[model samples]
Target chain A: MFRSLLFVPGNNPSMLQNADIFMSDAIIFDLEDSVNLDEKDNARNLVETYLLTTKELPKAVVLRINPVNSDLVDDDLKLLQTRKIDYLLLPKANKISLFVLDKILKKIENKIELKPTKVICLIEETKSVIDIYELAKHERVEALMLGAEDLTSELEINRTTEGKELLYSRSRIIYAAISNKLIPIDTPFTDIDNQDGLIQDCKNALNLGMKAKTAIHPSQLETINEIFSPSQKAIKWAEAVLKKAKELNKGAFQFEGKMIDRPVLEKAKKIIEKAKLFELM
Target chain B: MWQAGSKESNDCLITLKKSDKTKIKIDSIVGHLFHNQILNAVKDTLKSDNINNVEVLVEDKGALDYTIRARLKVAIKRMMKDV
Candidate 1:
């Protein structure tokens, strides 16, 4: 359901304070990958203020903390115990056993003394691709973000402006996320100047049943959000399908003079679901 | 801190400067940033208390320590009260 998630470097207090103005569907305060090793602590402390002082933050707030294997993971979870942190975004998560996730979940629950419901896992490695279905099945997992940087590292493939190299991994992610009813967020398009590349990636994600994507810069958010959203034509088609289904008294039917089977029907339903996010339906 | 475990260091950076009724600078903070996780801890500390700010700056490494935030807030509050 997150139509756009922007990653602001965890160290930048200004970006954290003003993140709401951009109005992305979600904001990722990155403590991994983006931050220098020396500045991680300062970055984390700065985020705490942003989390506390702001009201009605324009979107869902997710903290992109370092991987569980990293040195700071324990302290990060400990601090989150009493604070009103949102998603626990674990990056570089590959081949995770339920034990690992459950352990982390327990730690968070004990600290904040709250039930564990929110978690976003980054699927960024080839090993993760094999275990994606199982990873998606984890009850606490609500969203799966495609982390191309690591994906490229694991696969030994380079990403191109056209995004052709990511096709297989992208497809597998969609299949896995959709099967588990979890939201799939696409990888960031690093070539910020290539407007055409971002648009193509968003279109591909949309075609594959993805609902959102990550952005490295604020400027990329607009194109990604717009492209991934339901088109007016799509919204109209969804309305027509539902109307026709109601009239025919059947779950399966035809639309646009073609058979609209379950898959097609579900696709149509998704259109409405996504459209509802923008209040179009 | 932003991550899970570490008792070795404070995860944040803290500074106290007299307003001197001078305009606050945006770019840098004078107090040194502790190694690695210190910056994150300071930033995370922001949630624990309120800040009135003379001026505060944080550079994230990989960890956000809570003490960093707490120190900054206490410093800011003290500065605000003195005014």
Candidate 2:
């Protein structure tokens, strides 16, 4: 239920400690792209030390590690051998890469006698799109994020705020994640200055049935969380539906000239649950 | 020893040069206002990492204790090239 996942640069100590103030649903300690090439070890060590010392991290903690093919991946995994990380985000994830990562994680878990760490895949390449179903089927896979920046770069297409270039990929990801029961997280808007564009983009993602998005800056967290959380109107509708469902007691019913069936009931209940979780109820 | 990090707002520049007789010498360019806060933390971290003999030069740019400690560890590791 991570509506907004904030990416905090692993190498930036101020940003790492700033997690206490930001209200992102989840915080991704990025050791991949955010860390400079020579400072990979430094970033990994910093994150490990932070986790070991910090007492109360409000948001869900995720570690975005280097790609499977990179030389730094081993040391990155070594950090997990001793630290408690809730999730491991594999950058540029594909079928082959995930298989390799799965093996590595398994070995680490065995050596450390630690519990399984949930896995998240970054779907940003065309090859990954072709094999997304397989990638989503990983036992540890719990979520998938669309990395539009890298995806567009690979496709040699320009990304637009309107999101025309990412329609197909977005749709495919939503479908795959839904079918596999994985959470679908959208990419960051990348335009830190244009608040209006970010709002429009988030609304579009919500319309496309995405439940979460990554935030590069903390300012975007509020907008993303507000968009993804169940609105008051939605909560009211859910409450009304529950009341009517209890009254009906059995079978489908007609409400507002629309069919109120089991699926609709389930959606209403989920909306209410989300509202309660966010303490909006 | 070796050096790591930069003089960025949230970072520190640590220079670890080899020393003799297992003696530790620490000099700071911006450790006055905080008194012995940054240097003390760096010293503790160095001891915990089993680094006893080195000349530690710290150029603090308002880095947190964690940043300063991490920079020192990297500098020592690069210097030793053993761990």
Best by TM-score: 2
> Can you write out model 2's per-residue Cα lDDT over A140-215, one digit (the tens) per residue?
9999999999999989999888998888899889899999999999999999999999999999888998999999
- If candidate 1 were superposed on the true structure by all CA atoms, what would the RMSD be? 8.7
Clashes of 2: 0
Q: What is the lDDT, from 0 to 100, of the residue A10 in candidate 2?
A: 88
Q: Please write out the lDDT profile of model 1 over residues A73-145, one tens digit for every residue.
A: 7656654653566777877665553447568768667866787747887888788877888888887788888
* DockQ of candidate 1 against the true complex: 0.08
Interface RMSD of the candidates, in order: 8.5, 1.2
Residues forming the 10-long window of minimal summed lDDT in candidate 2 chain A? A50-59
Candidate 1 similarity to native, TM-score: 0.76
Show where candidate 1 strays beyond 4 Å.
A251-255, A261-263, B1-83
For candidate 2 chain B, the 10 contiguous residues with the lowest summed lDDT are B21-30
Which TM-score value belongs to model 2? 0.94
Candidate 2: misplaced stretches above 4 Å?
Answer: B21-33
